[model samples]
Target: MNDTVVPGRGDKGLLRNRVVEVENLTIRFGDFTAVDGVSFSVRKGEIFGFLGANGAGKTTTIRMLCGLLAPTSGVVRVGGLDFDDGGNGIKSIVGYMSQKFTLYDDLTVGENLDFAAGLRKLPAAAAEKRRAELFGMTGFDRPLTAKVSDLPGGIKQELALAAAMLHDPEIVFLDEPTSGVSPAARARFWGLIRRITAVGKTVIVTTHYMDEAEQCGRIALMRAGRIIALGSPDELKDSAFPGPMAEVDFQGSDPAAPIERLRKAPGLLALSPHGMRWHAAFSEGALMDAALSALPVSVRVRKIKPSLEDVFIRLAGGAQ
Candidate 1:
């Protein structure tokens, strides 16, 4: 089977091994349109990502995918199951972890697990087995008696993930799973996420962190409730900045004048301030020559590859 990721439209036949397929998906609340004709398909065992700013419809689209909310219009399918059956089949094979904390803070680690398993109607022995298996997979050795309220943010998020996966769903949807956690904790959580994918399960994640989004096999960048760009990380980077790019550091000098000057330079398509420096994308070498000729001698110009943040800023950050 060909494992090509395609826009979820036109072709009626399913893409090879596609676990999730959405076609012209749109959701509206009163007059506000949350998701506007978004279409995408996900491959099996792939780490698919949804990226966007606040209210860009990442969560709203994910909610429709998880069968949490019905779409106002368009076709939706998850794990090869259509919504015609009232999403019962779709819900059975998917796990959803919301961006907000959904676990009961008053409960203990084991209690939370039990509560989640009970919701899925898992038996005592099955829940226990899955718990041990998940803990082993995640290297999570926190005591079952520990209160969730007292646990660290990282630990709590991991526990919540464990609860969501208690039923061993085929597809897992994690909405902003690593938000508001330490870098170390986020790294560790992604490690566990990698392990989950290693076992051949599909993961659909929505995250704000560029580094985390880089881990996705393909990313759908959303803006104004629509997919503005969709491709692999490298593909998106190339599409956003197809020509040579450079990072210009002012060498402790004021960048205000140089920024204004480069804005009018020939061959330069984009010039945006990134951190302490400026990233300039040009159609050719004329911009670099212009920078060297017009800018102060203290300035430093070095060629560099574009990162996912660069693409995000260019494509989804409203204006660069």
Candidate 2:
């Protein structure tokens, strides 16, 4: 992804009839303010991606939205229900999967499902039927008699998700659902997310992965309890780093020398090392020729699209 920042018009009524509406949400603990005056909305059936660095208030905002915590001063509405009126109604309509795997490791898969069902006050027969459906959906044919601890990481996550959604909530809040899972397992988990959205369930997820943010229908970039940027992937890229980017790699020398040289080159707006290579963004026709000409004979360079990581770095004033 290119780090180009595209200019954005203020938020419009794009999500006017929002399923989840937050207005000037703020949360504070004693003298420390966790979430500032942040406001955003999630439309029905939309996959909304919440993004931020550590301590950026992403979790605080989520907690407030889920009715797990009340904002110091702000209005929040979930599924058109007022959050402060009574949390019970809201809780019943929303499902949540925290970052930590919250299943009882000692309990069998069936037992876990049953426990969740019982908490939701589901009928015995209904809970049994739902358990079978969940197993089929997650591709877990293992006996429900097997303990949760006996399952692999991927299966554990799947079962957790199934449990969270057992009551068929209208909205699901997933807090870094793929945090510790393997790449393949992450992909499978995303598949389940798609399936949920296909059935008209709104998914509000928070993630630190730039690639994962790109998969969302729209995203909000947060910092210190405030939203720094919010828009589609392309919009944010275009606004944050409004230029072409080139990714350069060398066969011999370190990227530092080329990076420093590129910084002084004309038309090059930004240069930073990403892993073993260097990424440089340039205004159109600025340093395209000069940068290429200045590279060492042992170096190789190629132009690539800007990414979310680049945009975030630039917006945050190069603070990785």
Candidate 3:
């Protein structure tokens, strides 16, 4: 019924490896608070994720963590260096791939990488060597002469990832990397992300897809620019609905009587319409059993697992 923040779980060794830390981080734009008093830490080699609807400040928080925008308040540390409104230490260890495709359409694949290397100021030989390694790492089979516009959405996505990793930054920030790619492509892109962690690099990604969010080791759910829930997917779900859930569909067209009647039912935790049916959450099995029995026999009640959407609806006040 309240914000869920579970203590860190899984792999004891990794739990101690804190790579990013933030405390009371906040930023405002005149009369608006884009990111409010948020605090969380990311472990080394962890796939940390931020999930929220638009205007929830997911990007604003990411920007602060990446040192692109200095926070109005709070302490931030990346790789154990105090990032108190500084970019020097942050830039050397963080790679970023934005939600939008950043490669030049007219330029060839090689040219794009070259441009990225120039921006990073990598030497000619070092840039070439890193390119070869990244190509092998991402399974990039496309020829260097291939134009960016000629490639598919998935391929371009991978290219963007490769370019982000060109400098071998310790942490990678992926902002909706697979937003428009096919499901298979999304799956493949995730695999690439997994490999990045396998080799001991940390990743912080923001995704709208619930399934994609499930892949994260830990998640911070944001609402109104504040993290309402912080935990793994299962932890958040269990904490959100510490009871039974049921989907009920009325047999008759006019079912207002039962709907209004159940609103005041004792032990009823939540009741709301979801499309053609209504979803209900009860404090326990005893309450759920009694509630179901009190409903009209013509109505159909099916128990269901609580999902992230359910968590969002219950926690964020409404749908995004």
TM-score, per-candidate, Cα-based: 0.93, 0.90, 0.90
* Cα lDDT over the full model 1: 0.88
Which lDDT value does model 1 have at 181? 94
Clashes of each: 0, 16, 0
| lDDT tens readout by residue for model 3, 1-320 | 11222246556665468888877889999989999999898988999999998889998988888878888887777777655436677877899888876899999999999999998999989999999999999999999999999999999999999999899999999998999899999999999999999999999999999889889999999999999999998898899899999999995567799989888888888887888899898899898888889998889999998877777678775544
lDDT score, candidate 3: 0.88
Worst 10 residues of 2 by lDDT: 1-10
Candidate 2 contains a number of clashing pairs equal to: 16
lDDT of 2 by residue, 224-293 (tens): 7789999888999998778788888876577666667778888877777788887888886555767777
lDDT per model vs. reference: 0.88, 0.83, 0.88
Candidate 2 has a TM-score of 0.90
The collision pairs in model 1 are: none
Output the better candidate (2/3) by lDDT.
3
Ten residues in sequence with the least summed lDDT for candidate 3: 1-10
Over 4 Å off in model 1, which ranges? 1-14, 290-292, 318-320
CA error at residue 220 for candidate 3, angstroms = 0.6
